[model samples]
Target chain A: MMIRLHRSPSSSMARLIGQPDLCSVSNWTSRENQLHNRSSRATEQLVALCKWLEMRMTKLIAGTTISLDGFTADAKGSPAALYADFAELQQSEAMQHAYRTTGAVIMGRRSFDMAEDPDSYAEDYEFRTPLIIVTAKPPAKHPKEGNGVSIIFATSGVADAVRQAKQAAGDRDVTCVGGGMLIQSLLRESLVDELQIDIAPVILGSGLRLFENVDQRKLKLTSATSLAGGRTSLVYEPL
Target chain B: MMIRLHRSPSSSMARLIGQPDLCSVSNWTSRENQLHNRSSRATEQLVALCKWLEMRMTKLIAGTTISLDGFTADAKGSPAALYADFAELQQSEAMQHAYRTTGAVIMGRRSFDMAEDPDSYAEDYEFRTPLIIVTAKPPAKHPKEGNGVSIIFATSGVADAVRQAKQAAGDRDVTCVGGGMLIQSLLRESLVDELQIDIAPVILGSGLRLFENVDQRKLKLTSATSLAGGRTSLVYEPL
Candidate 1:
């Protein structure tokens, strides 16, 4: 179902959340209407806002492999260990459909530097979409590559990086690629809208946690499907 | 799907995970063959194992209200806030069916002590089932009460509490009530079979974490469904 955000922030609960600072919710939040307290009165606005955001913003949706313990990667930052469980999911039609909705990819600098393998840019991976890297020292701004994918670096931060990626995505969605820390920053800043995670059924006793130190926020599950090969695909909106 | 534990631990990747500490796999592990690497070879084992446990183990499941941030309660340990989101879910048929499967209820000392209401021991909540509590100090070693639910205390740790609870449960499942610390111990000890958390779509920015300081382990999701009143019911088995 397409979720829309209700802008009726007139309830006392709405008033409680309408502080100027919070009122100035990011374009990501304002566009996606990701604010939700889910309390009796507050939940109404949340539901309304969720509906609005669902339609307004080019959703910053993320597709990643997350372990049951909620780690996106191992302690050494390698993603292959746990993510390999969903190799088939990465190549599935559902995944292809998800990627087809993406106009651009936003990722941390580390992911940018590490995404050198030609196969990693396959249609199964990201379809050679335009890439915007959130970095302190972005590499030389390159226009579209031979694959027709534009690669740009945003030295500014998450918001600016997302803005550029959103513009680049046109009417499609922006995919946030991760390296944990940067993902945490985007989530903390509430720049993300939907999370499409393929949960691998393996546990690495310890690793860089997927939701590490990210601010506490409740998510409304839009869908949870048991995919082929034991991987679980979960789609959620931050309420 | 009936998940069976495929005992093909001969994969090179399986060898990587077949270490001695993990190999002293509990009778629970051996009985259920609770192990999975999720490599091409072992992923089959994980799939099989997840199904087996789902069917075999009269799981010691937890049915608690948790916030989106993975907290079971507030920092002060009060669970009134986010938990209220599931007032309707508590009265759900799904919840009632889940409770009907309960043979016993295991909880921490705090919960036992704080459960001053007569209704907490009701057929709906615990159905006056056998209540096994883990604590250093055993309250009075009471037998079955007038409510037909036996109330017992285990001064020992998680294993003993689970063992006793299992014995009392016989053919039924055990419900572990959470206060965070004890549940962490159970999860850390790898004694918990299934977690049925009703995630309230609300954020408590600061509170005691649901799985605070617990060991990191991947959980295989058995099922996830949106319950009544917007709460999401998630059932997972920790690997």
Candidate 2:
């Protein structure tokens, strides 16, 4: 008997089973059947498998573009210097992959307010998924939403915001963008799984640093690739 | 007629002449002779060539190993975390190149003091070159020196120290080894020609930062190579 599973859900199951290409549960079920020789044992194995899959379903990624000196934004809270090569970097393979895999976004209230036209993000932003704003209080008026973009004001806390975002993301990844405080909080709580930085070839002597007050965490370099216009993309995973 | 120049001296001469591989001065003199066709003019050209070679003979390089988050040392002034991959990175091609090209070293007093046994550097340190110590006052007793390593105390200022170091380096490069203040002063004076960083895969939340208070400068990425043990070697030249 063969059991078909959703590709994303089964991908995590495959990873858990050490067979990354196993897209269906049929092979594992057959093996379990052969080993147990009983229906009850098979049912228990399937339940355990589902629990494992649920645990590894969603990944939280903190991503940003920073200057060579590690500043995410200039003193005036402007990221203009860091985004000089944005047009070119936006077309990079890693960025395209992020766009394709991002199922939801979590941002701080300041980042949401920084957007000139929040409603425009619904149509123009690359990650047209849901947006969860972590704030102490919800805004007086909500922005218009369409094109699969819905805003949720999470007034609870960072952990709760992450929970809501993960639930919304389902089997895809939840990406945290903007506000170093938010990322630092996530890093402190061990909620962030990946950290992605695109280092631009400029030095900002004074600015808002990306890693300020971040909890100490050892990272393993997963990838380092030179991008367009002298930018470098470095991806790290917590070890 | 062929005019042979020392390989290191002529390397810079070739760079100045826009012919990087023209090790011998014959090609350039021959072309000048054809253009001028006068003995007196040839003498003037030779004098001008000597001055140009003098100006471009030595390059000042600032090199260090830093954590992924840009910390050079831990809170207690220990670089243990940053040098975790030092053994592997030291054998990398970029490190070997730096070792081969460096003709002298400049370090701050604190960095020199941090050495448990300063005399041992004469025999063990990779750069086995003359060490220039920039301090407010010279130490009461000098450390023992041998094997082409001599210590010089420069109390005048960073500029005078650089000038003396460049004179000692001759046609080879002068590498600034430690202390952020020394590097920052050199940077403020626009004395640094190259910046080389070996980025280790660790994060130290609190430590000495490398680029703190550095002047704003644009850099051109000369090279970015992944070295042994997940360390990255990034070389940059100020634009």
Candidate 3:
């Protein structure tokens, strides 16, 4: 069935979108006319422009890996020790890319708890950014302050935490770093903007999952990288 | 306002998930109980899993950058030109990851038209996989045949193409390499399984968009990576 899809920019929706003032009525008409022509070639170009404007509203970042069943760590703070070496993860191109764009980070109680260990969190997270811990309880002692880094406490609603983080970001990117608990909260509120995952070679037989329950939502992969140690990193933009 | 959330999984339509045996009522209850217990984590895990499964369903292998105004490409089939060096792009970790997991690829007619340059396609596509072109008209010629590469012609239907692709993939992964028109069809029919995209460095003054006139389906990034030339890669799993 050859459906005649009119690309009239002056159509009611286009008029609303174009706002006669924003796009000029004549400009809208020409744009819509192109759609009316049903040019497979032309339609592709137009759609791309609309999407670019929509994605500019916010920025979000996520990083985590859990059991196949989807747990971030075991009952204790132990995070199932999946990736062979943080050294390899640190050196990968994906890691470098993550560091370049992110200006702030949000962490869950559990992830923050693990991060307190100088051996793991301190040495592991060398990237300089303001870290916000989204938890019910504040850390016994903040690390960033002592180490010439900024560590802020955000123990409230996810939206509130994000607002605080964005304010701290000051036109920079933010990364949501956590296991399942914190990530779920941000996701439910739809605060996350970009997700980066490192696929470790091994899957724990039984442990916590990064995902367990939530209404389904779709996401698209924007980039991918495979490390030498059988680890693959993928980046996603929400669809 | 505490919304009295329903405790039963039946309402969420997850009652049938992971059910070991569908024949008995008692077992069903037990399965539901087990599933419920597993879901008791903080809401964060649920969101991640939702995003994960979401991307698993709809995302195809290829990605395209289109304008926000809703066009797939310009009148001449040029969606937008990527100025990033091809040599550097070829060596990027993200490209390498795509090569590693991808066993087959599919593209729509519009996307195929962009590949009109046989030499660039031949030189850039180093990974050996069966590339299937879905269109009404057959190609005028074949370039890289008999080197573990073959181009099959399909006149209609993405679902059928996927079935044929699975046969070709054998044990490897299959990807739908898209142009906007093909993606629209796939998204409408729900044939896509994964979406991987590399947001290029440049935004065209105007061009086609990745999604146009589609349902409000959601996707979550299972992984993300940043590349060398300000390029970012993301992978989405469909809900």
Candidate 4:
């Protein structure tokens, strides 16, 4: 039987299914009708599908690492004061992959201090990613505009800050770049959704820890990637 | 000037000091001299003391709030889940303060089915006070026994189950408690440190909430309190 078409020939769906002689057109029309029927019949199911995709799409995480001891700073309050250098780890392919995939970076006041040039780091970061400085202090007036980053001094709350950052990132990722204090603060607030740690080969016998004074909780390793140079990267999705 | 050596014959220190002054005590004379010096220093410091007193400590926080959208379930499965039930919040508080002060409680598998729990919550919950749970499914299982209340179940991953439940309970108090997944798998992986929650006021609309498929990184209130009525409660925590 010929399938009657509603639209013009330019509508490929209409022309392809309107031919009278070909069983191909008949089968195509039937399939289209079946799809339409199913969509209408299972509206709830379709909504669920949309929701599932939306959740997956809208999902974003800020990943960072700190020492086991939970100290993002040293006794003098320098974030880089605690650890040896991360030069080797930073140069790895995994680090590059993470940087490329992430749309933006989330940082706290203490973490921001570690960047050699807070302003320049925010401005000319190699990745060209957006920078979000999560701080309780009021934002300083930008010395100039289009520094390639927008500084947000989030005093109101962490959740609110993340929400704003996520929106800014659109459909990309947010990487939490720093040591323990900011991460710990976020952890204390339950704001960080995922944690990815690159366990370096050497351990500092005594220095600022990654999670000092942090509440006790559990972390499950969702993915573990072992790098060539005795380095291991672990990805954990909060339970 | 040489201080007068005299025994009041009252206090232990005076008596001992005088004995050391005696020549017959020469065998242990050095020890007695050391004791006498220490006693004299104590007396001098006591007399020099300006003030001595005890004080209670209270850390100040800006404030926090956690709201349960109709996502969590009650015993029944319903969309209109309990957002804030003051009664439940009180129960959670009581569970922490009365039952377990220093230990942990477990959560179940179905409890945290949405998102993974973050480490931020865990560090906050477990630093001084610890909670723990067990589970096998999406939501984490609540931990029972040891040093806290029993388990509640939410089927989820090991790390998140422990992290979220702990963070949901902020500074007020908490103990580790989760259902099957948290305990069975997370516990084995050592992700959970404690469990605590603040039940809220109002009844759930209907359904198996409290543990459902939630976002892996969602957290509501950190603290909750019981109200005048036995049934109503409030759960609020910084997000």
Q: Model 1: which docking level applies? A: acceptable
Say which prediction, candidate 2 or candidate 3, comes out ahead on lDDT: 2
**Model 1 lDDT at residue A216:** 60
* lDDT (Cα, tens digit) per residue for candidate 3, span B1-239: 11222223221333234334434445457778676556544244554454334323322454554321123454455643442445687787766776776667787766666665754554566667777778777767755565666767676567777656655664456777677677767766766556665555342324454554454344545665665655555565544
User: Once superposed on the true structure, which residue ranges of model 2 sit more than 4 Å away at CA?
Assistant: A1-8, A11-52, B1-8, B11-52
DockQ-based ranking, best first?
2, 1, 3, 4
**lDDT string, candidate 4, B166-218, tens digits:** 44333232333433223334324434222223222222223332322211111
Which of candidates 1 and 2 is the stronger one according to DockQ? 2
lDDT per residue, candidate 3, A26-118, as tens digits?
545767867654554444444444333222333668787542223355445456455555777778767787778676777776666764463
Note the chain A TM-score of all models in turn. Answer: 0.70, 0.79, 0.67, 0.64
Q: What are the chain B TM-scores of all models? A: 0.70, 0.78, 0.64, 0.27
User: Which candidate gets the maximum DockQ versus the true structure?
Assistant: 2
lDDT by residue for model 2 over B1-239, one digit each (tens)?
11223445653453454423334546577767565446456555765666556535678899888887788888988998877776776787777887888878999999988878877777777777889999999988888788888899999999899888876776678999878888888888888888887778887988999888886788888888877676777788877
* DockQ (0 to 1) for model 2: 0.58
Score candidate 4 by TM-score against the native: 0.37
lDDT of 1 by residue, B156-235 (tens): 77888887887787557788877677777877777777877666665565677665566556667777677654466667
Look at candidate 1 and tell me the lDDT of residue A127: 55
**Candidate 1, position B89, lDDT:** 58
Q: Score the docking of each candidate (DockQ).
A: 0.23, 0.58, 0.03, 0.01
Which candidate do you rate higher for DockQ, 1 or 4?
1
